[model samples]
Target: MASLAGCLTGEEESENTLEVLHGWTGGDGAEAADALFSAFEEEHSDVDLNNKPIGGGGNENLDQTVSTRLNSGDPPSAFAGWPGSNLEQYDGVLGDIQSDVWEEAGLEDAHVEEAVEACQFDDGYSAVPIGSHRMNDLFYNVGVLEDAGVDPESLDDVDALIDALGTIESETDATPLAMSLEAWAILQTWTVVMLSTQGYDAYMSFIEGDGDESAVRDTFETLEELLSNYINDDAASVGFTEVNQDIMSGDAAFIHEGNWVAGAYINEDLEYGEEWDAIRYPGTEDMYGLHIDSFIYPGDNPSPEATATFLRFAGGETAQVAFNQYKGSIPTRSDVSTEEFNDYLTETIEDFEAASEKPPTLAHGLAVDQSTQSSLEDVLNNNFADPFDVDAATAGFMDAI
Candidate 1:
């Protein structure tokens, strides 16, 4: 691991410095980001890389920080962002990168087709993807499940999951489910429940403004029940990281989070399949809840060539594999082998490939625009704070979009 000073300093200062802003400042995410930049700096010895990480929280915090920087006219040369509607917000400011960077890296054939397509905006490709995360992962402490006499493979849907939760609650003192009260985390749980109950097409249609209202209400109601019945009582005071601790310590049985949890577990030297294991969120086996972390060049970048080089490196095999390996995400490139990854990632790769439908995740800023996402978040936060009201929550969700 090289220090930040080493990344920015050299005998002869490089001709250009690429300033990159991203939100991977903790745990394995930080380590992976650092490794990528270090490799990039080594390969392009004459180019200096200034890696700026916004560390307060997750994507929402990073988005706010990036927004502040952009508004203040101090945008970085390049920054990490999501695909789909999220990228649309920076349309004019984000460089295409497809013609200049993607081709140069030979990523068209190297990357997964869907992953590449997700980066494309109406105008053109607005970003370069580094990895793909399955947002609908349900991770559990293997020992906890075993102690509770629960069969990990037998829990397939919401009902079975509830029964297992009951067993865990009755047989062991562990919290049946670990969750965070963070707006995004709550929304993630809500989205998974909605997808599970309403089915894939309906879930997509509802988010897009044309689906069954009854189904939506039912999903909300079920989510409320699940939260009220199964989650730890102190969830409101904790964040996802704390919930992760609950899982690792056997204080909680399950956590419905993205694959990033795998990275955290790996960083702690917890073995996959032994200490922790993952499965698709119940009833989501046929679907891939997609989350992609990508980089985009800001329009005001001072060094286009340097930024282009950085994007090229990010999308290439060497950098993508190196980054995702530590980051606990599958490489965005379909051609990349999983030999370096753990068993968990190998299983995720298979799931990502076998899924019949792939939908963007609302929690991670892919399914909707910022305004809609914010509106929905407000409703979800309100619902999480108060007693569940299916009618009221459904109405609020309808109004959000």
Candidate 2:
């Protein structure tokens, strides 16, 4: 069987059409995929690209489909994913991207090095670093902050941010913080809070395939503090889409989410950098905003041509800027000019750079494999529900991992 690399390169019978698969289905997902495909078509007029977006609402179904396909000796030319420990699963279906081009693209050496080392299977570069979605960003309404007599930037620490949310809730009859109770959204939001307060060392240990009980316990304790202050009584009842609407309509004062919220705001024709702004979740000042998108090349099947083209384009500065701007993610290549990005994005980039200057906290999903990821999600779900038993939750989590 020809590898994805060979398929990408036209080594096999010219399948000029590149079939890119992802889990983005509707809403912002559709917008993001459309932006990338449109850019690809504009650039490579000769290549017919088919962006096969399979699932919606953070689709796990499509992820399963793609994984099943890859494991069954079939894989797309390139697939969207997050780079982390799980790249080990697809042992040899990636193509090696050239080192020189990577450097030339102005990808910070550390970012490239991390992706290469962590995402690599055995052969070479397992995946190209696409734009990153900072998971821990908190979006809030400026009026809400002003009405509460609080400075938006004052939320640099966890305790301060919680107090601010509480004050805002008390002063205005609005929900202080709005979040959907959906499993993934809850888990991702909590994961951000956990990573921020618990410190990168512990977060990285868990992400790097180590299950540190103390780290998990600390994270949970911090989450308990945060949940006590922020989450509203009706949290368990609302969906993410409704949560987004609440935030947009100013019914909720704050939302902890990824960069895509900006895109969602844009789609709603809501004013940004004025009505609202985004900040890295409180206490992440020393951490790089979490990087949440990955594209891995299969090593065993080796589609050198296709893989090369895909990696080159995926990592290139032009593609990075275009995709990220429309998708509302930070560009992977730091060299690209983000002048068009609003104040919130600029502030996020500044924070990310500062965090990088220290050390990085790997996204929890990246640090751990699928099994551990599932376990953590389950633990988080139970914790988010009632009867908040920290010990039982921690015990169940530690045992599962």
How many clashing residue pairs appear in each of the predictions shown?
0, 19
Listed in order, each prediction's TM-score against the native is 0.94, 0.83
Question: What lDDT tens digits, residue by residue, belong to model 1 across residues 285-366?
Answer: 8888998888877776667788888888889888887888888888988888788888888888888899998888987777
Q: What are the runs in model 2 whose C-alpha is more than 4 Å off?
A: 1-14, 92-118, 205-215, 232-234, 237-239, 267-269, 299-307, 356-364, 382-384
Q: For candidate 2, report its TM-score.
A: 0.83
lDDT tens digits, residue span 1-401, model 2: 97554656554444555667887666456676777667767877656566788875555776687788788877777788776665655555555554633454444453545554555555445677777766767888877777888787878777888888779878987788887666677667656766777776666555555658877777667667766667767777776666777778778788887778777776566677788777677777556655557666654433445445656777776667666765667775566676966565666666666665223323234656666667766876776565466787778766765
| lDDT (Cα) of model 1 | 0.83
lDDT of model 1 at position 176: 93
Candidates' lDDT values, in order?
0.83, 0.67
